[model samples]
Target chain A: MAYELYYWDGIQGRGEFVRLALEEAGAEYIDVARQSGHAMGTGAMLELMKSKHEPHIPFAPPFLKDGDLIVSHVANILFYLGPKLGLAPPDEKLRYVANGLQLTITDLVAEVHDTHHPIATSLYYADQKDEAKARSAAFIKERIPKFLGYFEQVLQQNPGGPTHIVGDKLSHVDLSLFQVIEGLRYAFPKAMKTYMSNYPGLTALRDTVGKRPNIAAYLRSDRRLAFNEDGIFRHYPELDLAP
Target chain B: MAYELYYWDGIQGRGEFVRLALEEAGAEYIDVARQSGHAMGTGAMLELMKSKHEPHIPFAPPFLKDGDLIVSHVANILFYLGPKLGLAPPDEKLRYVANGLQLTITDLVAEVHDTHHPIATSLYYADQKDEAKARSAAFIKERIPKFLGYFEQVLQQNPGGPTHIVGDKLSHVDLSLFQVIEGLRYAFPKAMKTYMSNYPGLTALRDTVGKRPNIAAYLRSDRRLAFNEDGIFRHYPELDLAP
Candidate 1:
């Protein structure tokens, strides 16, 4: 059976990470919430989320249903799918390393989300713009450099070489890193413009993942959603600072 | 050999989650940052974090070193340690479920941290008290109930029953959940006073885990740090509004 991906339809959000992995490996999967028809769409996704029968009720979306098993959280989903999709390192230990790197990406993404919604997710962005501005300033100045620089160093120091994040293989960590760099560049073009040049290894990795035949095709496909204000990576001109 | 746990010495923070799991399992581990001696303490921890040779340099602390392998992130470390410490479900599939639950807790903990430092982690709480108040209001009114309620439902709906979060075993998920409840109650006693009644399953789980012999002992020991302003969960009377 094809894998069922349950995420809110529209912006890529966290689901994009899973989509990139699936697409890269040419795996059969359904973007369940994006499909149109009976028993499809966001209703189906929400229904599963609220379903009392689901023994493993996910706290949020972007969960994967492989047969009867449901895997939630981006890093957890990737850890489970990586080996099967051939998007992970062959060594068992390196796989854990990949998962750790993916979790680091998860932390960075959460911080990015908070930049635009500093006061409260319940409040309008307009109401919290002041807080957002301060948060974004700190995020741009401190966090982006800390996280991306750590990743850059990791890439440069990779035993297999700087070609991939773990071992010699182009694992899901690389794909997620590629997506993160893309999202950051889109969300903070001004800040990233100055900061991007500092991390040459990450820049090369981003380019390599983007140019992958499947990823290149996927990027052009309708299935790939554009980054918007509603997504994890939002571009508000005022929040974008100079590094 | 003892498992080496590295995190900030003073605050419970994220490290408490891992500590709870280890304590419950009676696992022999060194709290490296808290230890006093040559080749120990926070300096040694920082040295390893910036070590040029470590292929897997953890993005931050609360990382565990097992022999030569280093595992980072609370959930990742627990996932790696779970089986070895006999604190995870025996079923391989349920291990993922436990991990997913642990990751959800991770998300909740991050949100809790933000309630006290909404504007920026670099800035002191005094500098962003206004933003923190607004954020904490929403957190107490919306996020706490939402997250805790979800966990309550998951526990009640567990196939193994409400005794544990995953399977019939007392897993790391249970230990983490216990810490979350403890933290929330400490942080927002007023809000949780009303909210606690609605989550009897979680409340019971918290109590059960607390009464467990090892956990009870650990709580009385000096090893368990007290919750303070420096920790993830902080009690600011202004932020702890009535639910």
Candidate 2:
């Protein structure tokens, strides 16, 4: 049976991380919320989240359903999928490292979300724009460099080439790093461009992951949604810095 | 071999979740950062966090080093420890539910952290006091009810007694729930008092978890640190609500 992915019908949001993995592995899966019929809409998604029956409900979208296993939390979901999809290393230590890197991606994603919604997730972006401006400024200045620098160092230290985050082969961490770079470029074009040159290895890894046959095919496919204001990584000119 | 828990020396910050589990399970472990001469200090912790050696470095503390395996993130660490410590259910489905509950706790913890540092983690509480006031007001008014209500439902829905979050047996979620209750009482005493009586089942669970022989012993032991201003759950009168 195909794995079932339940998330908002539209926009990438957190689900894109799952999408990238499923797409890269060319796995059979259904984006349940996106279906026109026999599936729940965004309203249903919200209701399920608020439902009292499923006390073990997800706090947010991007939960995956594989047979009976219902998993949410981006990193947690990926931890289950990595080995199943052949995107993770076989060795236990390497798997732990891959998972550790994915959790770091989770931190980066949270930071990205915070840039736009520093005050409250319940509030609108416009309501928090001023705060976002200040938060984004710090994020671009301190957080981006610190996070990317760490990734760069990891690449340099890898006994394998700098192509992968964990080892010689592509793991879930590489795909996530690629996504982070993509999201940053989309969200903060100017700032990313200004700092992009500093992390050449990261840039290269991003390019390589993008050019992977499965990923490249998936990107060209209609299943890949465009980044929009509704998504986690939105492109706002004011939030971007000039290179 | 004892699990080596690496966190900041002083505060019962995020690491407390892990510590509570180890304590309740009567597991052997070393609070590495708390050890003198043998472990890294705050500066070393910061440097290690920024070190380029591991691309998968944790974004923050509460990382666990068990033998060669290093795990971070509160929920992730618990996910690893839950089963190892015999605090998780044997069945996979039950394990998923426990993890789901743990992830929810993570969300609550993040929201609590944001109550004081709404604008940015880099900014001081004084810098964001106004925003925090607004944010904390919302947290008290909306977020608390939503989270608490969900936990209440979990207790009500449990085929087992309302004493556990997952099943009849004690799990890491129960321990974490106890910590959540304790933290909320410490951080928002007045606000919590008004709602405390409403969730009797949850309160019962908290009280029961606290009364567990291992937990009771741990709490009385010097190993259990007192909650203070340095931790994630801080008590600021202006930020808290009245009963």
Cα RMSD to the true fold for all candidates = 0.8, 2.2
**lDDT by residue (tens digit), candidate 2, A1-243:** 999888887788889999999999989998888876554566666776677666466767888877756787778788888988999988767776777778778878887988888877788889989888877888888888988987888887776778788877988889989888999999998888889899999999999999999999998999999888888898888877653
TM-score of chain A of 1: 0.98
Per-residue alpha-carbon lDDT of candidate 1 for residues B1-243, written as tens digits (9 for 90 to 100): 999999999999999999998899888999999999987999999999898998889999999999989989999999999999999899999989999999999999999999999878899999999888889999988999899989999999999999998999799999999999999999999988898999899989999999999999999999999999999999999988997
lDDT tens digits, residue span A94-167, model 1: 88889889999999999999999987888888998888899999999999999999999999889999999889
Interface RMSD (Å) of candidate 1? 0.8
Residue B144, candidate 1: Cα error in Å is 0.4
What share of the reference contacts is kept in model 1? 0.84
Cα lDDT of model 2 by residue, B4-59, tens digit: 78798778888989999999888999887777664456666666667666445666
Q: So what's the TM-score on candidate 2?
A: 0.94
Give candidate 1 misplaced runs (Cα > 4 Å).
Answer: none
